[model samples]
Target chain A: NAGVTQTPKFRILKIGQSMTLQCTQDMNHNYMYWYRQDPGMGLKLIYYSVGAGITDKGEVPNGYNVSRSTTEDFPLRLELAAPSQTSVYFCASSSQGGQSPLHFGNGTRLTVT
Target chain B: GQQVMQIPQYQHVQEGEDFTTYCNSSTTLSNIQWYKQRPGGHPVFLIQLVKSGEVKKQKRLTFQFGEAKKNSSLHITATQTTDVGTYFCAGDVTGNQFYFGTGTSLTVIP
Candidate 1:
């Protein structure tokens, strides 16, 4: 059903480059989240949106920003990518916050050089 | 800071052997969810435990939520090659966000 779709499965960015990570869900969920996973580590939240026009910072929100303009789209932007931003970015959505199980995207592996 | 820690950062077990991974949270959680990510894939939701001291089984996997709701465990009864993946426990400490554990990478030797 393509529950959650993410673009650019892999990318390489030069230092200070900016890019956007696109995420969309067809489930019409209200909760959406962005998380990054370093090599051999767990996922860490970057940003989240509870509903349209609402966004919030997560544990690791530096160097990144997010916007939720529509019910189906939550995009994460990297204003000035750094070497430390190299990680696997995952987009997830759930029917509800916390109570519902999350549906994650295939993930985008970003490498900042 | 609500942190979730998992024991045994990595595990290698022979096929047909049992394996278990533990997840402990710094703060009490209202619910804990388990997810598994295969090599080169994203995390996939496995199950969730809400009630205190709750236990649920799915095929060969068993998930248990401690009575205190601050700890959880995932046990695989008879592991196989297909079970090779990283297991992560995500806790909902405030019913608004999920803090994922450090994760336990499991490898099954066939």
Candidate 2:
């Protein structure tokens, strides 16, 4: 079973460009999250969804947006890429309410120039 | 917003030596989890502590939660090269968001 799948393992974007980071989980988890990890830093929450049609802002959700239209998908969108936004992005899912262990995707290495 | 912080931002130890990382939360936590991330890899869940003053062990690794439920620690009995990675602590405050600590990078010298 594919726990969590993230598309565009690596991507490079010019400043002001926009892109979407796709995330899907086959585990039928109810909770999904988007996080970014900078060099030598911990994961910073960006956006999260508890269930379909429900989403919320996380600790670091300024430059990004998220939508959960279906139970299996939660995608993160970067409206305008900036150098500071260049980092490794990860998608994660949990079966229970943030109380369960999180299953994370391989991650997407994004670079903005 | 609840904050979780880790100490010893970076550590280097010789093989066979013990290592530990501490996690402290700005407020009381409902629970806390530990994760390990290898170089250029995603974070993987290690263990979770829910009860105050709880302790759990995974072979060579030991995890503990403070009595106040606001702090935790992970201790590795004997470090190995395979243990080289960054350890992070995530705390659940409101049961909705789990704030992650800054993380402690550990390097083992063989």
Candidate 3:
């Protein structure tokens, strides 16, 4: 079974461009999160959803938006990309918040020039 | 805001040597989880420590949680090439948010 799946493994965008990074999980998890990792740095949370129709901003939520329309899908939207947004974006899911281990996707490498 | 810091940002060890990475949090954590990410790969769950002064082992890897629940450690014995990766410790603090440590990048030489 595919635990967590992310589309467009790699992409390059010009400044001010907009795009959506799609993430889906088949494990029936209720909590999902979006994180970005820069070189030699830890993963920084961008957005998270407790369940369907519920979402919250994270530490680095600026310039990004997220929507949780279904239990299995949590998509991260970059409205106007900037050079600072060039990083590896990871999607993760857990059965519960703060108590379960997170299952992560391979991640999408985004480069904004 | 809660923060987790890891020491020795990068470590290089011989294949048969032992390596340890320490993680400290500014605030108490409900639980701490460890993950390992290989080069050009995603982060994978290694282990989770919940109780105070807890220690768990996975083969050659040993994980420990401090008594105050604000610190943790990951020790790898007799490291091999397969042990090369970036190790991260994520702390679950109040408000259900995770604060990830800067991570320790390990390079095991053959």
Candidate 4:
């Protein structure tokens, strides 16, 4: 089974543009997280969902929004993207919250010019 | 928010040399996990530690958790070329989320 799937493996957007990064997991995990990794840096949490219809802001939530409308899907939206938003976005899912191993998607490489 | 930091942001070691990376957290952690990311790849789970002062080993790699549960370490004995990657430690401050360390980039010199 595809553990986690992310759409738009690569994208280029101009400043002030908006786009959505789609994430879906087949494992029926209760926890899903959105993270971004800058060059030569660690992953920063953007947003997270404990389950369907529940969402929370993370450490670096500015300029981003997330919705968990379905158990299998959690999408991150970039509003008025800036150059600083150019980074690799990863969507991860875990069977449990902060206790189980995380299954991460390949990641979306976004470049904002 | 809890913060996790890793030392020696970058390390270069000769093949077969030992290497270690340390992780420290600003607050006590409920659990800590280690992950490795190869160049141009996503991070992959390595292991997790829940008990204070617990140690686990996987072949040449050994992981340790601090007694206070605020720090952790990963040591590789006779590191191989395959060990070249970025190592990250994620500390769970609460039951809901984890704060990831800055990461240590290891380069193996042949």
Put down candidate 4 lDDT per residue, A1-113, tens digits, no spaces: 98999999999999999999999999999999999999999999999999999999999999999999999999999999999999999999998889988889999999999
Which regions of candidate 1 are displaced past 4 Å? none
> Evaluated on chain B only, what is the TM-score of candidate 3?
0.97
Q: Candidate 3, residue A102: CA error in Å?
A: 0.4
Once fitted onto the true fold, the runs of candidate 2 whose alpha carbons sit more than 4 angstroms away are: none
**Candidate 3 overall lDDT versus native:** 0.95
Candidate 1 has which clashing residue pairs, if any? none
DockQ per model, Cα: 0.88, 0.85, 0.76, 0.84
Write the residue-wise lDDT of candidate 1 on B1-78 in tens digits.
889999989999999999999999999999999999999999999999999999999999999999999999999999
lDDT of 2 by residue, B2-108 (tens): 78999989999999999999999999999999999999889999999999999999999999999999999999999999999999999998797789999999999
Q: Which ten residues in a row have the lowest lDDT in candidate 3 chain B?
A: B91-100
Using DockQ, rank the candidates from best to worst.
Answer: 1, 2, 4, 3
Question: What lDDT would each prediction earn against the true structure?
Answer: 0.96, 0.94, 0.95, 0.95
Query: TM-score for chain A of every candidate model?
Result: 0.99, 0.98, 0.99, 0.99
The TM-scores that each candidate's chain B achieves against the reference are: 0.99, 0.98, 0.97, 0.98
Q: Residue-pair clashes per candidate, as listed?
A: 0, 0, 0, 0
* lDDT (tens digit, per residue) of candidate 2 on A11-110: 9999999999999999999999999999988889999999999999998999999999999999999998999999999999998866899999999999
Instruction: Locate the minimum summed-lDDT window of 10 residues in model 4 chain A.
Output: A95-104
Of the true interface contacts, what fraction does each candidate have? Answer: 0.80, 0.78, 0.70, 0.72
